[model samples]
Target: MKKTLLALLCAFITSAASAQSVSTVVHPEWSKNAAIYEANIRQYSPEGSFKKFEEYLPELKKMGVGVIWIMPINPIGKVNRKGTLGSYYAVADYTAVNPEFGTPEDFHHLVNAIHAQGMKVIIDWVANHTAWDHPWAKTHPEYYIHDAKGNFVPPVPDWADVIKLDYGNAQLRSEMINALKYWISNYDLDGFRCDVAAMVPTDFWNDARTQLDQIKPVFMLAEATERDLQEHAFDMTYGWQFKDVWGDIAKGKKNAADLVAYLHGEEAGYNPNSYRMLHTSNHDLNSWEGTEFDRLGDAVETFLVLSNTLKGMPLLYQGQEAGNTKALDFFERDPIIWKDHPYRALYTKLFHLKQTNHALWNGLAGGQPQLIKTADDDHIFAFSRSKDNDQIIGIFNLSDKARKFSSNDPILQGSFTDPLTGQSGQSASAPIELKAWEYRLLVK
Candidate 1:
């Protein structure tokens, strides 16, 4: 009897182990090495229309952008609106496109055009809340949360334009899921970039993901950094902690050691298969906080390189390639002034490297970063990521002063080429010199 009980216990443990080994969230095959670009349609062009933005498809493709995450296309709520145009987060309708951007047909054409260019497109989904004027607010009031006086309230005190949703209502969940399916079934959308995903219930996301996958494999990106979101709901989550660390380093408040510590912490906290979206600037940062130039200053390019070569997926915001310096107005129409900038070339090179090099691919598809110890560990951040035959060693001077560092690691002594400069040379045991905020990438 004791022997039989031991055998049963062993069987149960083996089954549990096998279950834990398998990831619940399966990432789409196309997203394995893809870099995501945030397309802010409202500020992308002077016209701010889908047709106008479609003209840039070839250019974006040339830049090696794989996934284009377009901002919310739903109509804005006019009641209690913040400005003349109102916030994009305040969705007036889920199924209809905002007439200001273009007609629904125009959006359909844009999605088709993006796919034609061999790129995937994902639209922003605001599921946690809806505009105060949303039809459901009146017809199905139970879909929303109410105050003590039976009045609808915003998710937060500051966001008065939008009202919070009640996931406790099962009917609301079904309707919301149905609305999500409508886009996939009608427009053939690849996936969604869920807004404030953490605020909503996790089970809803899991159910939605399962249903969406039944139609087709979808890529889901959450706007939050919560690790649990990646377990079964999202393919990727925002790496806000890394962004904060990068900003602190630029402000002289942190150093290379701090950056290394953060990376180690991230590896320990999050699942290895989960993709984290790394970016120097996004729509929120560019419009609310500041542009990359404002926050990162001279270290802008350095951090950009780090974001791309790090162990996660990199995000390039619209206008970042053009080096737009102004803080775009959030509530009004502020067009990005396109110009010839070095940033475009730099991004092109880094993105191409990310595409061709398996070491820089997204999530588990890429290699884990191994620190290459250097003499100046405080200012010089050096690491190597290798997958099979492909390898990349990144050396960055994270401070303002010049740095001279030498690494005795055997991986550093090899014939490599710089993807950015197209220069080929052999790295010896000799000390390497780098200017303030300079970064070097060696590919083998």
Candidate 2:
């Protein structure tokens, strides 16, 4: 009987350990309260050089930015390349910097400058495919996926300039991992924003995360929204559904009720410890879809506030603060016209609030959002978050018309200050009015 019991106990222990998720994996200590800024080197300045970008580091740091995610720096394949300079995603070599951006030494200097400014850096990685002329096509023909005719093929019909990689090939997986490690070993990069991470196998990402952690705890951001990816391989995933819902609201097709439902659905579906990246604009959205102003109209800042204060890590894409109002030319040189804008100050204030308020921290480090009941739930969205002694309440008029609402929730009836307008006072169940597309963020 003792022998049988011992064996059963051992089996149970192994089962529990095996069930541990990638979400529980080790993360760098620095990421606890971090916010990410996506830097598109090409569109950031006219020169599109790393050295020129390095000059903007101090200003970004002053804005309370913590992590900088630079777009791909690898050389692009000339064969079958698209556009005037080729897509940055069509990587020709994994280990070298794009000469158009600058030399490898110049990149190193830029990374050092970012570090010197007390910020972390992550590079965009395109592991799902490579440029058609990538040496692997000739040196390791077996490493790529083949069409029905047994010829190398692109992953999708539209991505003709790049060919897909076959993760099924063990050697290819090994080589891909080696290339990932090479960047960390050589450039001292903090982590990666994996492009189309869902196209690659989850096991490969799990293994890569494990191996990369052996060198140093790394932050991984997946461009996809697979929950399993966050379980062990990624620290964060794209909040695609959130963006979709917001877009619908901006278009007057959805309302605050829909947002509340989404919040509940997200809470029930995603792991409590998983971080979601919230953003109003990104490379794909700004270049392919449309700029936030074009999509959201006069409600642009309203949506931006929702992204920042929501229960996730906020993402500020390149030139978003300056309100780059046009869809940038994806395949040609289109530089952002930098100027002093209210959006800059807005982000600076919101980012500082995110860093200091434990109630607003990322993932498990922060508070769970408690939806505050209010009259006119269809137009007025209200919620509060509390962690320890810190508390934050956010109320927004998501509709195009002005909204009037009354809230009797005890959590909101107290002395509070509005971070945006600097108004402070005790609250009651009295009716409150908000202008069209206006929001209030109260803190105690």
Candidate 3:
């Protein structure tokens, strides 16, 4: 009986190995209902270590942050580096954890902590380039992109800090795949958010997705807005064009009517399951363009209202919920000063409402957004989201002054309570009044 049991155990192990060795394109169960949270390790906390950030798993879980997308944790290359510590994208070693962040054991602890909170962790991946001091740069020089003079060049003309990778080499592809597998199998990483995905070849990503799915279920988010990148690989793509349009409208360079044409283009250009990440602020905007306060101006609240009600996954960047006013330096050591603020209360209420509103969910599972035709459509934006008996009506004043807007849209003619306050409102034949930057969220 002992001999028979040993044989059965050996067979089970072999079967499991074979299953993991085979690649697939389908994702497993952990990612479907998940919400993504961005973790900027350097600026997230005072210590900026994996150990330090691990303390927030419970709070994140409480706040409904389902998937934790950690910024790059690899050793920052120093040779021709940009800042004191160098860019995280300029990786010195893909296989090892950055000593500045923590040890490999610390990372394991962090991943375990996130998992213990019933959350998933997908890390940021920059596979298109590497730091000049990367070992592969010296040992396998041919793997890098060479210029006319046979010298390795950066990915873009202005990217003087890092070296570009050559994708035409099959050996490089195999090595990258192995590195990815090592992380997934050894650390239990849930998925990846690929940086500048449009710069990389599509076939490589498709292969990577297939290889990753074999080990476990994974979620893939691409930084590119290209439609063909979706295929069987990525679950979501950046809504960059929409974000640019928002910037234009805020600057008075474009009108709110532009959103209609953009949405129509997206509906026809992308896949049905192709999730678009909608955000008010991200790393680039906070670091490069100013904070949401500067970019959105008095229209901030109105834009935030539309961001959640739109047909996409809403993103809350770090410090955004705290009314972050400082412009974070991208290449240096800057910690977000976590403090008591009004934006927290506003976000807490808004997030709570978003969670409970079935009509405001993402994609086909959510209701269609219908704009409420208003008299002052330029300054006052009114819209409604409806799915069956469930509906949410929103009205916001984007201009600098208080405004009264008349909307005759039947969708906005419902009786509902403003969950932000306990007051109930039943619309009549008259127009609704709103103060500058003030917004209303009502549900029926």
TM, every model:
0.94, 0.94, 0.88
Report lDDT per candidate: 0.91, 0.88, 0.77
Tens-digit per-residue lDDT, 1-444, candidate 1: 969965865665455434432247889999988999999999998799999999999999999999999999999999999988999999999999999899999999999999999999999999999998999999999999999999999999999899999999999999999999999999999999999999999899999999999999999999998878888889999999988999999999999988876665444467779898999999999988999999999999999999999899999999999999989998889999999999898888888888989999887888988988889988999999999799999899999999997988988777888788788885735688999998888899
The lDDT leader among the candidates is 1
Better of 1 and 2 by lDDT: 1
Give candidates' CA RMSD values in order. 6.9, 7.7, 13.2
Model 3, range 1-444, lDDT digits (tens) per residue?
969965865665455434321122344455433456788888887688998889877777777776788989889988888878777788888899999888999999999999889888989888899888899998999889998999999998777778999999999998988888889999999988898999989899989988988898788889998767777678788988877877777777766455544554444456445677888888878888888889888777678766766767777788876778888888888999888776666666666566667676654556766777688866676677876567887776656678887866666655688777768876623587888766777888
- TM-score, ranked from best to worst: 1, 2, 3
Runs with alpha carbons beyond 4 Å of true place in candidate 2: 1-22, 426-429
By the lDDT metric, which is better: model 1 or model 3?
A: 1
Clashing pairs in 1: none
Compared with the true structure, what per-residue lDDT tens digits does model 2 show for residues 1-444? 969965865665455445534466555778767889999999999999999999999999988998999999999989887899899999999999999899999999999999999999999999999999999999999999998999989999999899999999999999999999998989899999999999999999999999998887889999998888987899999998988998999999999988876665543467668888999999999999999998888888998998888888899998998988879887788999998899999999999888898899887888888888788989999889889788898889999999986888888777888787777784534677899998888898
Error at 310, model 2, angstroms: 0.8
